[model samples]
Target: MQTILSVSELSKTYDSRFQALKRINLDIRRGEIFALLGPNGAGKTTLISIICGIVKASEGSVRVDGHDIVADYRAARAMIGLVPQELTTDAFESVWATVSFSRGLFGKPANPAHIEKVLRDLSLWEKKDNKIITLSGGMKRRLLIAKALSHEPEILFLDEPTAGVDVNLRRDMWQLVRSLQASGVTIILTTHYIDEAEEMADRIGVISKGELILVDDKAELMRKLGKKQMTLQLQTPLPLLPPALAAYQLELASDGNELIYTFDAQGERTGIVALLEDLNDAGIVFKDLHTTQSSLEDIFVSLMKEAK
Candidate 1:
């Protein structure tokens, strides 16, 4: 895969007292949905700001589409679009006027057709004539997206794009993100919603205390870190796990109604079949069996705990 954005040894410091970001390095793939996951003040916004030229790096360099963001500010910025977390826009301006004005700011010639397409794609066409102050929170977010796309940027940055959005609107936004990727636009988004990142991101990057901790393909990351649990509802309550089964490292529920087995999902052998056979040999019976895989939320919490 081609690299659309690269960050090398990037660091951010304020007043030379607080370090917001460490020496972080990342490569965002072209035309892919990359999700940046982090807690509040994890430097996600700072990193995005530096890449978009809003904040200056304390040290290191960033290149967007082979253009250095600092040395070639115009060209690098022209290839990128940013929808910030805040809903900052011309309060009195109509959606159409605001979007058109953003395009003009980028030195783009007036293209009504392109503007109309962006608005329609974001479901903002009907609200185009309405003032920003009159729009709903969700609509305002869409307008931000519209304004970002107005310039026809190759890379799009979505900072908490679906924050406070309803379920239906979130789904619509997810679909729209896919449509944008299909149109050859690279997307890098920071989101607090773990499920959203799990569902939409091709790759997941985790940041902790302003340091890039992990970056891996979504499926690969899950497989690497995901754990599976097997629960067996026993027909007969066992006060304790049999000594013979101790080597299996099984856990006994306090109620004695179930036996739980924890295993790595990436392991070649889950040992469930052997455990079942052992139970049969021991004259134990199970009424039912169930299994569950760890979710992205679980992984996120675990990572945060480790970082803390």
Candidate 2:
């Protein structure tokens, strides 16, 4: 994939003598969905703001589609659209009027045909003439997306796009994001929902304390760090693990009714055969057993803990 955006040695310092971002370097691939995950105040929003020209970086530089963000602000910003987390649209203005005005803000000529398509694509056509105040929360969220698409930008930044949305609306937004990607838009989103990243992102980037800790292909990251567990429901309870099973490092669960063993999913040998044979030698019976694989959320939590 081609690099759509690049950040080199980026840093941000506020008036209060606080560093919001450290020498961050990142590259966003064109036409791909990249998910940025971090805790609150992790500098995700600050990075996006800098790339979109909303905030200036204290040091280093950014290039959007090969245009310097600071030197060629207009050209760089014109290729980007931002959907902020806050709902700050004019309540008195109709959806259509607001969306149209947003397009004009980008110095783009009025194009009713494009606006109509954007509204319809967002499923906001029926509410086009309705006042923003009269729209539901989900409808308003969709309207934000419509306004962002109004300028037909090649790169879209969604800052917690589904923060307070309901489950159904979240699903709808996910579909809309995929549709946008299909239309050749590079999407960069910062979200607290791990599942959103797991389901939508081709690549995942994790930031902590203003530092870009890691960035990698989502599946590769999971395979490298993810773990798997197998739980055996013993037919008979054992107060203590046998000496023969000590090498397995099993944990007693359900008050000794179950034995849990955790191991690396990518390990060459799972040792399941040895474990079972040892169990049988020790006369430990199991009525049932189940296995589970770690998810993105598990890895995220572990990363955050490690960062701390």
Q: In candidate 1, residue 233 scores what lDDT?
A: 94
Best by lDDT: 2
lDDT of each: 0.93, 0.94
Task: Report the lDDT of model 2 for residue 234.
Answer: 95
> Model 2, range 18-83, lDDT digits (tens) per residue?
899999999999999999999999999999988888888999999999999988989999999999
> Poorest 10 consecutive residues of model 1 by lDDT?
264-273
Clashing pairs in 1: none
lDDT of 1: 0.93
TM-score of 2: 0.94
Cα displacement (angstroms), candidate 2, residue 93, comes to: 2.3
Which residue pairs clash in candidate 2? none
- Top candidate on TM-score is 1
Give candidate 2 misplaced runs (Cα > 4 Å).
none
lDDT of 1 by residue, 80-198 (tens): 89999998877899999999999998889999999999998888899889989999998999999999999999999999999889999999999999999999999999999999999
TM-score of each: 0.97, 0.94
Query: Candidate 2: what lDDT?
Result: 0.94
